[model samples]
Target: MLFSETELQRVSVVIKGILTPYVAEKIDKNHYRVRTEIKRPGKYLADVFDSDNLIGKINLHVLSETQKKSGGDDFDSMF
Candidate 1:
């Protein structure tokens, strides 16, 4: 699908807002690495800093409508 530059920028802003508290690094074209403390459910505080420990990553690739419905694995078999 085609998206205008303005539309893409809006999407980026939304992503940044949702990823707050944890620092996000754009490691690639669309991948991001997020790190935080190691705490279980209900143990996380709103203003706690745990040394910015390593946590996990997130991918924010744009997908076509068909890809969204089809699980976006059309090329998985090639590997």
Candidate 2:
């Protein structure tokens, strides 16, 4: 999820030091949703931009299948 005072124009992710752009959809006046398929497990950063300026950076952690099973299904509680 990405939010800004203005509309968001682009979304991208930094995986293993590579910046890859992803498709973004406007959900409302100031909110946007970015979806991407990450096959590898590791740490990543989601970058949000509005026109010419970068507005946000989100930290994302992807766990492997084994880790997910061991961690249980209550994902929200792990945070």
Candidate 3:
């Protein structure tokens, strides 16, 4: 999920050394939903762009199947 004060023009994720563009669905004026399949476990970066300007960068962490079953990290819940 991504949100911005301005409309987002595009969203792309860097996966496995490749820049992949994902479909961004606009829920309204400032909200967007991006769905993409990631098969590997690693860290990724999602770039958000509005027109020609870079608006935000999002960090995505993917866990392996085993790690997910083992309850990978609870630190995020602390917030």
Candidate 4:
């Protein structure tokens, strides 16, 4: 795997502190997919990197009450 279990756990904690939760799903022997939801208002952001180089990011917004209220069970289901 490109990332170790320890690395995934570390990232998960960081994501949770930003007001979202993430579960790391191993995509293959060398890749992973992070699943999460932005459950609050305003912009939500997270960044992934390899050393100093940026690898990925999530920048999302829940600007409407309906959007904030919808489709958030996935976070609870992850546990």
Best by TM-score: 3
TM-score of each: 0.26, 0.54, 0.55, 0.31
Q: Which prediction has more favorable lDDT, 1 or 3?
A: 3
Off by over 4 Å in 4: 1-13, 16-20, 39-44, 47-79
Residue pairs in clash, model 4? none
Model 3 alpha-carbon drift over 4 Å, by segment: 9-16, 63-79
lDDT by residue for model 1 (18-65), tens: 445644444544444445443322222222222343232333454445
The order of the candidates by TM-score, greatest first, is: 3, 2, 4, 1
Kindly list the per-residue Cα lDDT of model 2 for residues 1-79, writing each as its tens digit.
6667865556444334656667578889887766667878887866655554666687877778888887776875677
lDDT of 2 at 62: 74
Model 2 residue 38 CA deviation in Å: 0.9
Displacement of residue 12 (Cα, Å) in model 3 is 4.9
Model 4's TM-score against the true structure: 0.31
Please write out the lDDT profile of model 4 over residues 10-62, one tens digit for every residue.
33312425654454566655566655565567765666654444556656444
lDDT of 1: 0.36
lDDT of each: 0.36, 0.67, 0.68, 0.51
Ranking by lDDT: 3, 2, 4, 1
